[model samples]
Target chain A: MDIPTYADVEAAHARIALHIHRTPILTSSFINDLTGAELFFKCENFQKAGAFKARGASNAVFGLDEKMAKVGVATHSSGNHALSLSYAAGKRGIPVTVVMPRTAPEPKKAAVRGYGGHIVECEPSTSSREAVFAEVVAETGAEFVHPYNDPRVIAGQGTCSKEMVEDLGELDAVVAPIGGGGMVSGCCLTLSTIAPKTKIYAAEPKNADDAYRSFKAGRIIADDAPQTVADGLKVPLKELTWHFVSKHVEDIFTATEEEIVAAMRLIWERMKIVMEPSSAVPLAAILKNKELFAGKRVGVIVTGGNVDLGKLPWAQS
Target chain B: MDIPTYADVEAAHARIALHIHRTPILTSSFINDLTGAELFFKCENFQKAGAFKARGASNAVFGLDEKMAKVGVATHSSGNHALSLSYAAGKRGIPVTVVMPRTAPEPKKAAVRGYGGHIVECEPSTSSREAVFAEVVAETGAEFVHPYNDPRVIAGQGTCSKEMVEDLGELDAVVAPIGGGGMVSGCCLTLSTIAPKTKIYAAEPKNADDAYRSFKAGRIIADDAPQTVADGLKVPLKELTWHFVSKHVEDIFTATEEEIVAAMRLIWERMKIVMEPSSAVPLAAILKNKELFAGKRVGVIVTGGNVDLGKLPWAQS
Candidate 1:
């Protein structure tokens, strides 16, 4: 497998430049005071389709050559990736099909359809989803745009940290939530080359700490299905992402579900930005283990902002 | 009583430029498509202290003469103004005394105290608040900075639209929620002189539609007490605001409480930015009266993002 490099990230940035929003980096003095470190938040929550996935999705959809572009792309995700891929394909004016679980939120389904994505629903179980997705890909011959593991998608996510450095200059550390490890690996890929001194940290929920365990064990530790309030971080790390994590990641921190929710609430209250529970893990990790980041300038990649307002974890679950 | 002029706004902008955030304007294609008009949201929710009141509060605090500044400022707001004034006072390193109702949200009181402001509690009644506020002023000799009715405050608020027009070039109409009308008056102060072609519109909650009634009756109509999900807009328009609303405002539109909550939820979910119910009034108004804004490039002032996350208007009210 060809690993995505700085050059691939640069190419991805150029390709997705027009398709995705160059989201702004935001700062909260209150959060800075709370964390004892000045933090620059790369606000991917404000990206097109309301997440950083848009960057990777746009790169994948737009990078396809004329012949492949006609066939379009396909993905199986019940979350931001599905909406992001649909948004990218919609922008490119191409056909994109998303295989989603039948038990997925109705609003998520409507959002995908709203972006002109054709939905193929399967049983809520992972095996059923994988089986149905394979059938769809076999019939359509659409390029499979994996959410995080693919070189192209990882390269696209790298552009986020690239912009962060370009906009905010040097940083002592970069922290992001790790689920499938796409965003975290992207950070590692960029910082390992450009800002070699800047440490890369991956934050995960304690309930789904496969990445943490993998990093400690120096190997890939996949989980069957770990449940957490951070619904986005359930996926295990893939080979491509694990390569970057094992090589470049300084440490992996795990936050409790309550800690994640509390951090999310504090951010919404003080920073006044709406972000999902997954995005709060980094802050939770920092707050829980503050001594490491004290008085340093840190770059925090706020992953996404798609949450069910009617069923906020703190409120309902 | 002096009416704040365009020059006063310019002076206020210069004074508060260093202290306040030149918050970015956010656009949502989803909202744009839904409303049938292009909208530029002047994101004052991102302002220092999390509201446009920061502009005016900073102006008042920083504009103070050194001798007068020693005594600091006082106000009787249990809302964003209280926090904003405290934030400005904290910046200036001066004393800020806020007369808040004892029945106010503990989190709000904590926020006020967090900014190093002295809180003087009064009975949960306007009469008691005014009486206690007067006592605090009399005892401390602190300058009273009225939330919206003052020239300095209005001038400070004007900078929002000033920056909006500077950033977005031209807007066909500008819509803002009106309570005491600091933000709307500010828009009037700036756009009426500079961007004269931009028609000014104010949105009010039907539950507290004194401004709407005042606009229709061509007089200042003060309400004793009114309730709405938009807590910031329950206050009636004062004389300084009425001057602007009567002279420059083209029309005032009202949205029901349910509409206000729905609009707030939509903005939080789709825009992925947290703004208070008061800020949603403009969008609710636009959605309710869509044709007026259809095809027009309009500016919507998102006033604040300070809300009780635990008791969201949609989730509870």
Candidate 2:
């Protein structure tokens, strides 16, 4: 697969203009005072499916040919990606099937159903999910929309940066959490093209630092049974995402679980926004490496807000 | 005091421009779809001190005469108002004394100290609080900064609507939660002057429906030992606020405790904002009276976001 160009990002922005939310850019004096960085947060938590996954899902659904569109779309996600694909497909009057782990949050499951997606519950394991999704594709003949491992998805996610840059002007650096690396890869690709002088960084939770390890080793790395509050960052990296990130990203930093919790609390208390632990990774990275970001104009992508209020990691017993 | 005219709001906007946050207007397709109203959420939760009280506090502090400035300012509040006064006074290098109930949240007391305000804890009863504040002012010679009852504070709070009207042209109606009535009274005054056709409505919790009762009876009504998740809306209606609200407000509506909790959840889940129960009053009203707001352009002032995550009302035990 070819690397997505800046033109592809521009085209994606135009195509998904009406479909996705032009999420707000939030700046905080409290955050700036704490980190000494002029930070601009792209609030993708306010995106259509409560995450940046909507951008990718919308693009993939709209990119399909008439025959492929008739086949509809399928994906395996126990979190935001499932709901995003379901929402995007449903909006386009297309059928969607989502394979999710049975252990997924009840609210997330309800959201997928609310968006009219057919849910296939699989065992709570990566291998089980992939196997069930394969069977689903075979039975339904649906076009598979890879969550973060496809060029179309990456290009689509890049539109977020394109809009942010348009709205907030050039930034000295851009930071986003690296899960399967779709958002960071897209951010890197877009920033490298539009603002080449800007540094691009990927933040990952220490419990699920496969992307960080991979970036350093110049090869794919996987973490099995990762343990972190940022549940969405547990997925292993794919070659397509790894390749794009390696080419465009400048560095990958890891944030400890405690730091992630602190950042989540700060966003809740100071910014007054409900950010999932995955979304807090970027802020965690900034807070952890304050010296690196101090006095710099930085852009951070808040990737999603799909947290269960009841299960918030910070609530003291 | 004269009712705050559009000119007064414009003047307050200028005076407090450097002191408060120009909070962003938040829009969400998910929330719009759920409510069937084209809604614009003015995120005062992102304002300084985690609420719009900052605007009033800052205005009151800075609006004082040089002689009065040297005397400093004092107020009685459970949380947000104390923090706002502390923050505003700290900026002006003026000493501030906060009279807070002994039963106030620990986090709120910490915030007052964190912002460098001197605290004087009193009994939780309203009479006790008033007596304690009066003693503090008499002993320290600090000018009283009544939360939501003073003209300067009302003028400052009016700036919120001024900014909203400038950004989102010609709103059909503006909704605010009424506690002491500072926010709604200010909003009503400004909307009446600039956008006279725009209706101003106050949302009150059913458990503490003093404002609704007062609006109907054409006299001030007080809630004794008010019980609701909306701690900020428990304060009784003041004479000045009651007068302005009676003349300018189109109506006052009440929402149940369950509806407030549901609205708070919807804001967290759909809009990705951590709104306190008081802030959710407008949302609860909108959700409960959909036919009244259907297809109308409505603006809801999300008053504050200061709920303790550990003790959130909706958190599962």
Candidate 3:
């Protein structure tokens, strides 16, 4: 197995630079005062497809050879990844097929289609999704791009922190939400080499705290059917993501579903940016353990901004 | 009465440089494609106190002489202005008394109080508000900062467009929502001098189209109590704001209430920015008259982001 490195992050950034938005770093004095921490938010939420997944997806779609690129790419995602992969492949004028569960939100499905991606619906279970995805890959002869477990995807995710470190200079710590741990793994691969002093913290929803438990038990903890308002963080960490999680993460913090909702609303109100519940997990973690981050210069990754406006978490009846 | 000039905007920017946020100019290719116009959004919603009122309020608060500065400031606004004045005063370590209607939302009242502004509740009617405000001003000797009509406030608001013109270069047209028309007045003041070729457009809700009527009538038109989802644009244009509007504005466009709500949601969903209904009026206007703005580099000022999330216009039953 070839592990991704800091060099791969550099290569990924160069390859996908034109395809993705070098999203801005936003700071709010009011939010800083409330948290008692100087926070720099790397807004990947404003990326090409409204998530950091665009970076990884762009790398995979754009880095392919002429022969492989013609055949295009395929993936299974119920969230930002499907939209992002489609967005990336569409930019390259390639046809990307997404295997989405039938139960996925209509808006998410529409988004993938809107980006010129082909959607093949599967059953709601992981086993069914994979089984359907495998058939799609075999039929289309498409290059399989696993959502967060692949080296190419992890390298692409690393570009976010690369820009963060470059923009903000030194930071006391960097934090991001951990679901499949793609973003965290990317951060680890980049930060461990270049910004070795900066601590890496992975945030998770308490209702779906498999990553936190896994980190504590020093073993992978798989959750068959975890549920949370931070819907993006329901997946368990895979081996590739676990390798980086175990090696580089300083800590894993968990926030309650209520706390996540509050933080999401706070960011929307104060920062005036649309971010999903998953993006707020880090802020929830910071607010939950203020003592740990007090007076520290922290880099917070705003992972994505793709939320169904009609179904805002706070407004959910 | 002295009219505000480009020089006043420059001086105001320098005076409030440390106080106000030089908010970023965001571009959305998605929104651009939808509207068929190249739009540069000057995000004043991300401004201090979550509105462009911060610029004018900060200028008024900071430009005061030592004696007047000690006397503090007073305003009668149940909206962004009250919170902005309070924020400006708080930054200057001076007292501010806001005369708001007793029926004003709890969150708006709490925001004013949070910024250390003393609040004096008045009846909801305009007459009662003015009557109560007069008494407070007489008692405290606090210099009054009118939300839009004052020369100082107009000059402060001009700085927003000044930054926009500087950031994006010469725009074919600049459009902003008009209620009291402080922002549009500011744009008129600054652009009339610096980029005289740039056309200025004022957007108004058809339900509260006082500015649109006034522009056509060749005189000021006051709507005593017009209602619209864009709460910020309820007040009619006053003398000072009307001066610039009559002299420099190319056209005043009106959008339906439904159009405003749709545009607001589109910005939130596509641009990933939390903008108020008033901010969307300009976009709604652009979208309504797509032929007029098509293929042109247009500057749209997103006036504010202060909205009750629970009562989002689209989510209302």
Candidate 4:
């Protein structure tokens, strides 16, 4: 497979512009005071299908050749990507099947179905996920759109950073949560080409620190069943995403579950925006490692807002 | 005392240009489909002090001459106005004293203090509120800024509609939640002038339906201690606000507590914005009275967002 380039990202943006929202950027004086860094939040939480994954999903679904599109599309995702692809398929009036772990948030499952996507359940393990997804593809003859590893999806995700830089001019740095490193890799591809002076930082939950481990060790590491409140970020990285992460990322910073929840709550209370725990990881990392970001103008990708309102991370169990 | 006019609203907007945020407008296709109306939400929750009250408060504080500014400003309120006045006063480096109900949310109280305002607790009664406020103004020699009844404050609040109409062209009608009727009166004051054909609707909690009763009976009826999850709507309409509510408002609608909570949750879940229960009242009313708004372009003022996230109205007791 060929590694996706900035040109691919530009093509993805042009193809998906009509389908995706040019989501707004929000800033907070309170958050700026907390870390002494001027931070701009790219509110992808308001994105169609409630995530930045909609960018990649739309790119994959819309970019399909006439013959391949006739077969429809399928993917195995913990949550966001599943619903995003479902949204794109629903828009195009094509069939989509998502293999999801049964433990995925009920909200995401309901949203996927709301967008007319079928769900195939799997155990929260890579073996079960791959097996179930393959079974669905074989049964339906669906064109498989890999959640993160595919060059097309990487190119699609890169469009987020492209919009961010174009809207914000140049930022001193950019931070985004790293789950399978799809968003980070996209940021890397765009920032390296367009804003070459900008530093890219990847934030991860300490409980699911596979990306941090991979960056520090210079090799890919997989976690079988990492547990954290940030359910969307428990998956391991793939070859396509790791390509950009290893080459262009400045560093990977990790925040504990407590820090993640606190940062999420702060944004909810102070900035008055609803976002999932995964989206808060970048702010959590910045707050924890203040020296690295202090006095700098940074961009934080607010990844998504699809979470059960009843199951907020800080709610007393 | 004289009523505030469009000229005053325009002047207030100029005076407050430096002290307040020209808050953004948001819309949800899901909500529009559900209600069969094109809903434009003016998000005053993202206002400088997390409420539309900031406009009035900023105008009042900033409009004061240097001699009156030396003594600062004071108000008696439940929550949003208290914090809003504090926020405006803080910006001017002036003293602000607030006579607030002891039962007000802790988050609002914390914000008031954070903005360098002194809070004096009053009982949840009009008599106590007036008495406590009088004592504070006398003791501190502060200029009294009525939460809603003042012409300056009404003109300031009217600016919200001026901005909304400027950005949205002409809506078929405008809906705003009625607490003490500041925001609704502002809407009436502006829509009646610039967009004369656009009707105005006021929403109230059924539990605190003084505004509805006032509209029905053709006279203002005071509520002693109405109870509702939307704490901000507990106050009764005053003479100045009653003028607009009686003459210009098309109708007043009351919503049940359950409906208000549902609408609040729907916006938070779908629109991905944090807004107070009071803000949801207008949408709740719209959902109930669909015939009045169906197939029309409607504007709903999202009042404020300064709620304790720990105590969301939808959360279990």
Q: Model 2 chain B: which ten-residue window has the lowest total lDDT?
A: B1-10
Docking class of 2: medium
lDDT of each: 0.90, 0.88, 0.91, 0.93
lDDT of 1: 0.90
lDDT of 3 at A299: 97
Q: What TM-score, over all chains together, does every model reach? A: 0.96, 0.96, 0.98, 0.99
Worst 10 residues of 3 chain B by lDDT: B102-111
Q: Relative to the unseen true structure, what is the C-alpha lDDT of residue B308 in candidate 1, on a scale of 0 to 100? A: 78
For candidate 3, give the docking quality class from DockQ. Answer: high
* lDDT over C-alpha atoms for residue B255 of model 3: 98
Q: Which scores higher on DockQ, 1 or 2?
A: 1
**Chain A only: TM-score per candidate:** 0.97, 0.97, 0.98, 0.99
Model 3, A1-317: lDDT tens digits are 66898889999999999999999999988889998999999998899889999999998888899999999999998689999999999999998999987877677788899999999998766678889999999999999999999999999999999998898886899999999999999999999988999999999999999999999999998886577888788888899999999999999999999999999999998899999899999999999999999999999999999898988888864
Total residue pair clashes for candidate 3: 0
How would the candidate models be sorted by lDDT, starting from the highest?
Answer: 4, 3, 1, 2
- In the range A33-142, model 4's lDDT, one tens digit per residue, is 99999999999999998999999999999999888888899999999999999999999889999999998999999999999999999999888899888889889999
Residue B156 in model 1: lDDT: 95
